[model samples]
Target: MQVRLEQVTKTFAGSKNTQATAVKELDVTIASGKLVGLLGPSGCGKSTTLFMIAGIHDVSEGHIYFGDHDVTALPSDKRGVGIVFQNYALYPHLTVWDNIAFPLLNAKEMKKRLKQRFAELSPPMANFKAYIQRLVEEAAKLVELTAYLDRKPAELSGGQQQRVAIARAIVKNPSILLLDEPLSNLDARLRVQTRDEIKRIQKQTGITTVFVTHDQDEALSICDEVIILKDGVLQQQGPPQEVYDHPANQFVAEFLGSPQINLVGGSIKANKLYLGNEEWFALPESLSDQPVNIGVRYENIRPDRENRKQAFEATVTSIARTGGTSTVQVRLADGQPMRLHRDSDDVLQEGDRVRLYARPRTVYIFNAEGEKILQC
Candidate 1:
């Protein structure tokens, strides 16, 4: 099902009628049968956006549409969306079958939809009891929980419990699936395993899925397109690598990378990019001479064993070892700390001075107001 939001806004009243906007006038269309991710940091309106789609939070203004139906004022029960929360929200004492079947047993919306479906079936079939059993069985199979159907929640591993939660959410065959940080509870290895499983299940189900997460890697890896948010405003939305390479703003460039993008004070003087009096890169003619921030990814900076003259130089401040790669933090001449990506094979210690240069066509120049000037 296709879901679209038009000029959607949500506000909460503070202590004295002062309101805080949790979600601004946001407009996004989730295509039919696609997995889209809502990614951002804490309190960036990602969860608020998901909640509004689920009809748990009413919009302060504007409308929400499920395909052609305007469901702006619909209650949560009537939205036909299944939400799997971070906690997994399973009943400790109930078996997996019971947990997966609970939604089908209690949902009025499901009953209403099933009634409509029943009337449309050929020969006016009356196998209602058998249909529910098929739903439970199918949901379990989707999450690879066919063998653990009789086990309790506590008796299963963390990954198993999460699978049960997913099975429970999808059992009713919701029109749209809302997953809010669904894999945050599992360990690193289990998270990747379950993430792949989710992608597979989503492909088979073909439901419009909205996955909310703060992890950039998770969103980039599992989503077809990622919508980035910051401070109640939609920053950018596109395929992960598209947004990563060509960030719309400084916040997005810094927020999406692993070691974070480096921001250094630079100036465009006489059509040349100047970093602390060194002419390292050239600026485009479209961008006027002005002060700017040079955004460089960690991998774009390389340490030179032979200290080349006329190159941007810095003194090594610290080194952080993470597996095979090392993060070398260096202090520029202006005292600003810059980080470089280096492998373990390089022998560079703290307090060692090294000459470095920015990779060509791999840096971004943003104006003083944090707007993009150009990227080269």
Candidate 2:
């Protein structure tokens, strides 16, 4: 199913009847059978957008569509969206099998809906219970939980319990799968493992999935495309690498990366750009001279002992080594802080004077309004 949100807005009533807008005129199109991530920081309205799509939260304005069908007014159950929440929301008293089959058994007009959806593959009404059992078994097997079919939620590990929740959500074969920070509860290693499993299962099932998350790594690692939101407004939406390489604005550039992009003060004068009073690069003469914020990724800035004509002087303040990668912290002549990533084997001591050179094509310049004015 392809999900589309047209000028959608969500607002909440606070004390004194004040209105707080959660989402503002959000227009997005989620491609069919693709895993799309709604990614942003906390309170950026990512979860709000997901809930609106699931019909759990009502839209204050505009419309939502499942393919060509307008489902703006539909309830969550009526929308045919299966959701797996952050906590898994599994019943501790129920076995895995019962948990997976719960949706099929509890939904209204289950027999009729099942017959309509799985008519060609299903058996007669006399074997309905057997049919439901087969569905539960199939769901469990798909999530690699067939062996734990009789086990309760409390008895399973975090990863296993999450798989059970996923299995339950998919048992009904919903047209759209919605996951709300599904891996936030797991440890780092488990988060990676479970995310890979999610991508694999999504590929096999080809269900249109909307994943809401605040973690950039999870969003970039698994999602086909990511929609970045800030302050209840859409910022940027694109493939992870594309967005990282060519961000639409300063916020989008800074928000997507892991170690985060390094920002420094810069100015353009007479078609020349300067970093901390040191002439660094030349801009197009057609551009006007003005103050600008220069952004460079940690990997884009290289530290060198040998002085270069284009490089700026900086002193090494500290170094943090993580496995094979070393993050070198430096301060410029004017007391501006900057950082760069280098090989852990590189030898550099504190108080060492080093020249910092930024790759031309990787440099990003943003205006005072936080909009990208130049990206080389």
Candidate 3:
């Protein structure tokens, strides 16, 4: 199913009669059978938006559609959306099979499905138990939990319990799947493993999936497209690499990268861009003089051990190495701090003087209002 939110706004009543808008006129579309991520920092209203789509929270304004069907007023149970939460809300006393079969046993839904099944089959399809059992088995197999089907939730590992939750959510064959930070509770390695499994399952099922997460790495790794939000407003939405490469604004550029993008004060004067007092690049003549923020990815910066009287110079403050990569923290000549990516094998020490330069084409320039003004 293709999910669309058109001008969807969600508001909550605050103390003293004030209203807090969780989402503001959000308009976005999730293509059918694609895994899309709703990514942002905490309190950015990603979860609120997910809940509104699931119909757990009503929209304060606008409409939500499943394909062409307007479902703005539908309840959670009526939306045909399966949500797996961060906590993996599995029933403690239930075995994996029972948990996976829980949604299949819903009185109203089961009755409707059984009625349709009987209508479709000759002799009324009497073996209903086998049908539910087959569904449970298939769901368990999809999540790789077949061996643990008879075990209770507490008897399983955290990853196993999470898989059980996922199996439960999908057993009903929902039109859309919603995942709310489903890997947040796992250890680092397990998080990676489970997220990959999630992507695989999503592909096999071909269900329209919306995943809400604060982790940039997870979103970039698993999603077909990512919608970035900040302060209840849509910042940018695109394929992760595209958004990372061509950020729509300062917030999108700063929020999407690891170690964050290096930001420094700059200005344009006489069609020339200056970083600190060093002239960097020439802008179009039609552009007026104005202050700007220059953003450079750590990878774009080259740190040279020999200063060579370059236009920009810095002193290495510290170096942090993880695995084979290194991050060099440096203080510029004008006392501004910056980070650069360097080879772990390179010899460097604290307080070492280094010259800095970024690829001109990779730098991003943003104006006073945080709008991206130029990319060079």
* RMSD after CA superposition, every candidate: 2.1, 1.6, 2.1
Q: Which stretches of candidate 2 lie over 4 Å from their true place?
A: 118-126, 305-307
Candidates' TM-scores? Answer: 0.94, 0.96, 0.95
Candidate 3 lDDT: 0.88
Winner by TM-score between candidate 2 and candidate 1: 2
TM-score between candidate 1 and the true structure: 0.94
lDDT of 1: 0.88
Q: Rate the local accuracy (lDDT) of all candidates.
A: 0.88, 0.89, 0.88
Model 3 per-residue lDDT at 319: 88
**Pairs of residues clashing in candidate 2:** 361-376
Clashes of each: 1, 1, 2
- Per-residue lDDT over 26-64 for candidate 2, one digit per residue giving the tens place of the 0 to 100 score: 999999999999999999999999999999999999999
Q: Global lDDT for candidate 2?
A: 0.89
Which of the numbered candidates is closest to the native, going by highest lDDT?
2
